[model samples]
Target: MNKSVALTGNEAVATAMKQIEPDVVAAYPITPQTDIVQYFSTFVADGQVKTEFVTVESEHSAMSATIGASAAGARAMTATSSQGLALMWEVVYIASSFRLPIVMPVVNRALSGPINIHCDHSDSMGARDSGWIQLYSEDAQEAYDNVIQAIRIAEHPDVLLPVMVMQDGFVISHAMQNLEILDDESVKKFVGTYKPDHHLLDVKHPMTVGSLFLPNFYFEAKKQEAEALERAKKVIQEVAKEYAAISGRQYGFFETYRLEDAEVAVIALNSTAGTVRGLVDEYRAKGLRVGALKPRVFRPLPHEELVVALQHLKAIAVMDRAESFSTHGGPLFNDLRSVLYESKERPVVTNYIYGLGGRDLTLDELRRVFDETLEAARAGYYRNRVTHLGVRE
Candidate 1:
């Protein structure tokens, strides 16, 4: 039995956690992400779930504790945003390197310097190389669904890697939207149990974890981690399929909106994709062949799926909310360009850096980007390959 309810992204995530009822949750509060831990902690106090909630002193300690719990054969989860994620940098890599299967919901925010606390991809994007499987949600529904599925994906034996379920801070995180809530028993059955093959608590077979690795073995360890991430692509699909069977909502590595016959298209992530989809609908109704692609799974890249989805377009525009500071393009744009580089039928892709530090990305600004992409598709060249949309000139 599914129930419909209005929920902020943070509340939706907390609700999902209540249903899944993981063995442990070790978290430190940060702006935007703080509500998630706060709400879940209430459930802990009321004894709604049996999860052991650990309030850590810092983000670093939170992740370290979560890693410890996971290694001890318990399902562990946490939540954070911006500087909090930055503080967890060291253990972020360690969690994945050790294949701990820790699930974290990162409410995306800009990294500090200007000391602004708002939404952006910089935090999670910075940790892209940390080997966590990244999943972006477009709305509260996806945010709730992704966190539930992430548990299964991360714990799969073939892919024992941590997962980052991301939602744009305040944009999706604070905004309220109505979404379907799955019954607790259904979610529990779908997620099943977290049974690792090897664990510290398995007294019958004592094992070692996090041992120091020197040059001779360090390279091999990284290679194994890479392989596990690659294998997660298949596991992600499997979990999504099973989840869809129960939840009746289908998901993919990326979603294509009116792309079948589109000549111009935009690629985006998170809540902005909803805005892009609205623009795509308008253009579609106007008889323009413009479309949009929203990537759900960012890490592991989804090269083949992206290639198939984008191979037909004449021009592609990728919008990144966070600046890579590469002076070339944002992270999503760079990844798309690299993936399409080898395609026999490739689109002339362009990059749009927008909405940094919670700056507004107006509908008019988005419309102009689509107009430029259409113009470039017809002209066979971009006026400029890289652009900063919605920024002061």
Candidate 2:
């Protein structure tokens, strides 16, 4: 049985966290993400959950504490956003390098310079290569669901890596939406328990977790980490399949909307996918072969899966909420282009950097993007491959 509720993304995550109720939660306050931990603390104070809530002073300390807890064989969790994530950079690598399955809920926000607290993908996108399994949510429901799934995915025996479940700041994080929540008992059963073969707390079998490896062994260890990431792709699918048996909501590396026969399409992540889906319907009604691809699992990269979904298209546009500053294109665009390099036939893909620092991406602009992509597909060449949408001329 399921219960329907109107809850903000943060609240939904907090509710899910309460249900999962892991052994530890080490969190520091950061906007958009602050409410998630704040809500969970209430659960702790009220004795609704038995989680040891550690209040840290900085995001680094928060991540460090989480890593420590996880290394000690405790199921650990945390949340952060924007500069907070950037501040945790050093420990972020350590968390994955040590193969700790720490789950983090990151409310995406722009990295600071001019100092903005609004929604953007820069925060998590910057950490795309940090060896964490990343999941993006289009709404509060997906956020809650992904967090729950993340626990199982990260703790899988084949993929003992950290996970980051991302939601757009202020957009999905603050906006309320009606969602179906699974029963607590079911979530608990679904997530199961975290049993590590080797943990610092296991005094009987003493071991060093963060031991430094010399050059001879460091490279081999990195190769193993890479292999673990590849293994995670299968584990992610398996966990999602198992979760679907309980939740009735199927998940994948990415979602396709009206893409079966689309000649032109836009690929995006997070809440922008919702907007794209609406426009995809409008375009379909107008007899345009346009669709959208919303990537949920970002970290494992899902290259083979994306190639299959997009290889048949005539042209495609990748909308990136963050700039890679490569002067070439954004991170996702580079990935899509690189994946198609070996294909016999591939779409003329372009990159559109949009919605940076919370700039609104209008329907009209999305329509223009699709129209431009369709034109390029027809022409069989790109006039300009990289563009910045909604930016001042």
Candidate 3:
């Protein structure tokens, strides 16, 4: 039977992990991500769950331990944020290249430089190309469901890729909400067991993993990895359908609200999407033709779904919490533009850098985003490139 309770995004991750019943959990506490690991640690201590929680020294070591456990043919999980994620970069790439299906719950936050503890996409954006399947959650409810679904997607037989379930740092990660908690039996049935066909530490087989590759054959190995990722896109949809069958909660590559006939729309991910939905409601009530699109999954780009959803829109606003500083364009903007490159006719897709470095984005900012995009649609004149919103000189 389905049961419900109020849980924060971070807490819900811990709860879901209990449901998945991982054999080992290696994690070191980091702000925003701390509560998740802490709750799991308590579960470990209280005997509510039979799982090993390895407390490590640093975030780097935290992920390293998780890699070791996962490679040993065990279901492994970990949680981290900003600096912690940055520290895991090198190993993250290794995890994907080695095809280890490790899943991490990342409480998304701004990377340090000026030193901030608030939410942003900087951490995940930094590792976007590290070959992990990136899934963004717009609220605590979605956060709860995605973490469980991520495990199924990552460990699919046709695809063995690491998955990152990203939730907004302070905004959603810490915000309390009513979440339907799946019972352990149902979650177990949904996620299933981790069956590693290629486990490195199989004492019976004693096989090889991550062997050195020469320049001649390195391309072939990478080619296989690329194909596997493409396979993952479809596998994600299948898992989503299966998950809905069991839980009665529907999910997809992206969630659309009044996007079909809308002329202007804003595409966003994470907790901010909830805020944008509210603003879109206001505009809709006033007879303004504006809508919102929340991407449930980011990596592998979901090109077909995105193009179809966006094809009818006149103007589109893309929001990014992290700056691709060197590129002079936000990461989401850069990615969206690339995704739409081959389309015969595409909307005037513009990027908005909002809520960066912990800057507050109120309803006023959401209104401003819709207004600007609508005005551009009306004039039929706007740059087919990145834009900065809620940012002033």
Candidate 4:
């Protein structure tokens, strides 16, 4: 029922967007993420899809246009990377606050200062608290799949929130990989239709979308938004289960690789998980009890699930591609550490910030990371809680 094809991550996401064929597609061009919209634009130009493609001048306008479209009860989508995401900061929160079910595919790239167009989690990590559901992908296959699933997740009645599906720039975005793609009709049926209960275009109901909430009312509204995000966790799982039935691939908040019964393990997201998995196999073959954890859903945090999975381990090394500049550690490290704090028996957790600006994470460096974690497990203490890997001495 599916066809096997080789596609770059950008192409794969583009293909997914084509299949979903949202009512509106509004986006501006940015490296790594540009090709996704570019490919979809071709679908529009060729009459393959009847999506109203908006050619925006800036990322901010792109998001504003998407929010407008979604508010009008149209299923809207967009894509961005690096500074483009940063530019959409103001409207990004607006999209979520208004509870528009907009789906966006973000190609992860380092934020600029010295100006580098390369892979890193900084772009999306910076927006963690902006009230959007976030999903990270390890490869082209997951990127494609996540985009399709995001439509259902965002539009769920209980969880009408924007969703950001992220894939590593250059690493996953540009690299080619073989992936299974569902036929267009199947995807359409799986996503169904987008019929919002309330919209600006609903003249009979007539309501204000971005109405300002005074201090007395704002707190409760914000609380409701938080609850909606919490509800999204269950909706995400339910969607994944349904998607699995159709695609034969199962997904969860996070993936555990030989983690049950392992004493020490590495935790990461995006394409780095591939490296961790390969090294995990090598370590296991060498009679070591090392494993890996790849987090797929990040926004809802999945604290309880992660705590249950990690509480048994003696030590854990969290790999973060983006620096939090918190001095304590990166974003992922701090979040995981906070989650483990609630555990009855917490592991000795350390942080490794690596692969910034597209620096490759070699297996040798990963092996050393594992060895350090194993040593910490045996000694019951870590030499350093935070480290920057592959940096010049």
The candidate scoring highest on lDDT is 4
Question: Residue by residue across 1-393, what tens digits does model 4's lDDT show?
Answer: 799999999999999999999999999999989899899999999999999999999999999999999999999999999999999999999999999999999999999976999999999999999999999999999999999999999999999999999999999999999999999999999999999999989999999888788998999989989999999999999999999999999999999999998999999999999999999999999999999999999999999999999999999999999998989999999999999999998899999999999899998999889999999999999999998998999
RMSD of each: 0.8, 0.8, 1.4, 0.6
Worst 10 residues of 3 by lDDT: 381-390
Q: TM-score per candidate, in order?
A: 0.99, 0.99, 0.97, 0.99
The regions of model 4 sitting more than 4 angstroms off are none
Ten contiguous residues minimizing lDDT sum, candidate 4: 207-216
Write out the backbone clash pairs for model 1: none
Q: How many backbone collisions does model 1 have?
A: 0
Collision count for each candidate, in order: 0, 0, 0, 0
Q: Where is model 1 more than 4 Å wrong at Cα?
A: none
lDDT of 2 by residue, 156-200 (tens): 889999999999999999998999999999999999988998999
Candidate 3 vs candidate 4: the lDDT winner is 4
lDDT score, candidate 4: 0.96
Off by over 4 Å in 2: none
lDDT of each: 0.94, 0.93, 0.86, 0.96
lDDT of 1 by residue, 44-126 (tens): 99999999999899999999999999999999999999999999999999999999999999999999979888998999999
